[model samples]
Target: MKRERGHFSGSVAVIGGHDHVHALRRLCEEYPDIKWQAVVLPPDSTPCLFLHEDQSMPEGSFRIQNDINENTPTKVDIIGGPFSGIIYAVEELISQGGSDKARMALPSETLEDTPGLTYRTFWTWDHSTNWELSQIGQQEIGVFNPYGKPPGGFLRDYKRCVDFCSKNRIAAIVIYGFLRDSHGGVEAAKELCSYAKERGVRILPGIAIGSYGGVYWEGDNQYNLATWLRKNPQAAATLEKGVGFQICDLAFPLNFPRSDYTLSACPSAPETMAWMEEGVSWLCETFEIGGINIEAGDYGVCGCSRCVARRANEKEAARRRDVHGDYWSHTDMADNFPRLFNAARKARPDTWIYSEIQWDNLLDPVSLEAQRRLPVGGIYQHTTNRTYWKRISAELTKSYVEELPMQPNVLRCQFACQWNGDERTERYALNAPVFAEMAQLSYRTGMKGLTIWGEPSPWYATVELSYLAFARFSWDPSLQYEEFMSRDVAPLFGGMEAAEKFVIAANEIDANQRLPLERLEALQRVCLEHRTSGEVGRRWLSLEEIISRRIYMGE
Candidate 1:
């Protein structure tokens, strides 16, 4: 990997992979005194932490480890806090294609056995955020049920959320797009989809679409097609299920024996076009989903044989039908997405198709052109860093405006801060006022709606604050983020100072603390650790209220 200029000084060295070179650059520039050992590893086999005895630090000022585990030569860093943090951050940068090392390199479709990994914020630790936010009461501040469960297994929780939304007039709840767990099978997912539809909620089913980091396919969706045909005579599997490496998901996080097999398709593969027709038929009849959300397509270019041929024969395929690189440039996994999806629409006639394209794609040649060829209805993570919330808000609104002809429905997505495994969390602000920033950005950008990654099911004070914050923005976009947060937090803690201080302290924790467990412990310590003088400790401040005070201090 090319090192960013001015990253490491003449002092200590920082060794990481090509992808992290950017982050190292930021860290190095941010902390210039620390010289990076600069051990840039290949895409595969990155040592999580690079400080070893044999490896030398720049300037020799920093002491290195004296002894080495020569026998084991263990390169893995399994410390809980750092491990999970690294997992989350690295995942955000890369997709998990059934392997911990998926991002280590581009995966081969013709693997001995396909690998797959599931990513979701199904459960998080933030118990105090929920408790404290609950303690605040609705009389003084507004709260909302930002997210709800989708069409399947989490029914009880989903209903609770829907009722809350209905009562609060919450604009729209995000229904599930996909689920893969041992507890529920296809029958369960089908049921889940049914329930969401009966309730008239919009379902957000995600398709791997065109990313190298996600589940693409060589079109082997025969399972779905078979199910559709067995149940309904009218459905037909248009194309032969392409030869594929199947994804075997582990039943348990600990026991990853790969019990569940799923087929991922490549957009450029011939099988992809055939698979879509099969997928659409099943979806239209079974789930009756409103639309599909194409997610996280930043996998870069594909060197798959077909893509190579297409790149070489771009001039040749220029005259061929359904062979446009821009439309099918994701490699020969049959990337005729626009064409395939169009076929599905023709088959079903009403299902809406939405694709996610990011600003990052704007910089990548493969996605930049491919995404441009296929106009998207929705945009996730458009311009996250540096852009003003209001500026992005306007831009978001405009995104819808620009794509209205091709994509009628438009919504913006923001992940509310997630659990560090504590209700009262110091782990980090899981989801902060960024929701408001997003709302403002959405409205300003010309978005027709908003998608918040949240739920009413309690986790922590931060989660509660997050939902409340989301509601405030959803209810009124014109409201200033800081002001709304301030107002709600004050009453939650019975004092503006407490709420404001907590927010300041929360930001500090988010900036400094990264380990999930450590962050949680620190957050709990700050929240539960009370003032020693008699009166403060004696007062019955609920954990939720206490967390609220810590998180929203002065807001």
Candidate 2:
């Protein structure tokens, strides 16, 4: 067969195991014009891209080798230990196909890539109510409802998000605010879970144990916790102003003023422990999920008399101090977390369990000890731009992995963009470079995954860019930021010239918090002139408008 001069024209065949058949099919679908065939490998020589397992490749590692010569027909080999590697290899091929190089026949090249982190996960808060921000003193805090249903429905938007992640080869998708609070309810979550499973994506449902939302709060009776609290109201946690048993941290003075009086269940309470086990068991049984994210309590745990005593015990306190150093603290909830984790593990032995450790408590001895005791496989830690604790957190994660029998994975989380009250404000912060650095640093440490948190909002250009950069850097941290911007980001903004101007303006505004009126106007004009008619173009236009308006106002 005569091969085309500058396109994938001649007959091309893909051969792989059952696990990689879908990936091969996808590749064929991506280039419909190209004559593509899927076949099984024979004992004799067959010119094809062969996907095979290689013990030498580490977990989530893959290598692509293009062996094209004059005598031999075009043949590419993708070798990896996991199915995800196959997906990644196919994705790389598709990317190369889009370039001019791939048009001139498969370029003879050998490239090996591996994920720095074991699990690159992304989490959704679910509902709009969860994102409501309230002013508490100087800080504006929002209610974090991890299990709330996503606003404006779930299916269509969620499917789009899953598709993006699947294409990018993200490891997992975690949905919080499931069951009661979810917009479409359990059926929607189940459907989403099934969809993710089909796409080689793991789904983990968030289950809050210590903190119960108002949905479970029945007037004066707070579900199961109310029944226990009625018998011993003193067992409830004592809040800032000594309010008895708050519903959860979300109901604190800022976000949920109505529920401000409600207190979190005391971790030391036997009833609370029993309730946690029952809740975890019920959640596990209800969903066919890969795992459950066990939330110990939002904010801090109970400081009730009984809880205080448990936290104050000298022997336990000393042990905590030894493990956590100056960062150690005694919280009964820390001790109580193990019980909840154990209960969940007992209920679902095969399921993977992990916890979201708040940044403030990352080094807390009680939480660290509980993390060690729990049958959990990983810890999810998050940070904003302020990451002074990053090095310490990484060290602590390394120490825990070394000391423990089962090395737990550490998944670092960061926001793609901050959600200001107005959705437009989200575009103000474009920290791709900063986030990429953090991902690289975390990878160098013992961290196994990076989770970029954001809503599936359509107008979020900066968010999408941040996510793209994060995914790329997580897979290969050695990739430079400027290279990514020039090669990957520039394409989104029409071309390299426009992308460079947009990036420069964005960086200037990000650094100085504002741009000169003339500079702002010039960039806005440039963006307006070069803007395309898609989402990326719209985002650039929107950002330009924001900058122009701000500069004109002279605020």
Q: Would you list the C-alpha lDDT of every candidate in the order shown?
A: 0.37, 0.57
User: lDDT score, residue 184, model 1?
Assistant: 44
What does candidate 1's lDDT look like per residue over 276-385, in tens digits? 55554565566655555544232223445555555554432342223322222232322355654665466555454544443222222233333445544323223222
lDDT of 2 at 434: 56
Native-vs-model 2 lDDT? 0.57
Q: How many residue pairs clash (N, CA or C atoms closer than 3 angstroms) in each of the candidate models, in the order given?
A: 83, 18
- Relative to the true structure, candidate 2 has a C-alpha RMSD (angstroms) of 7.0
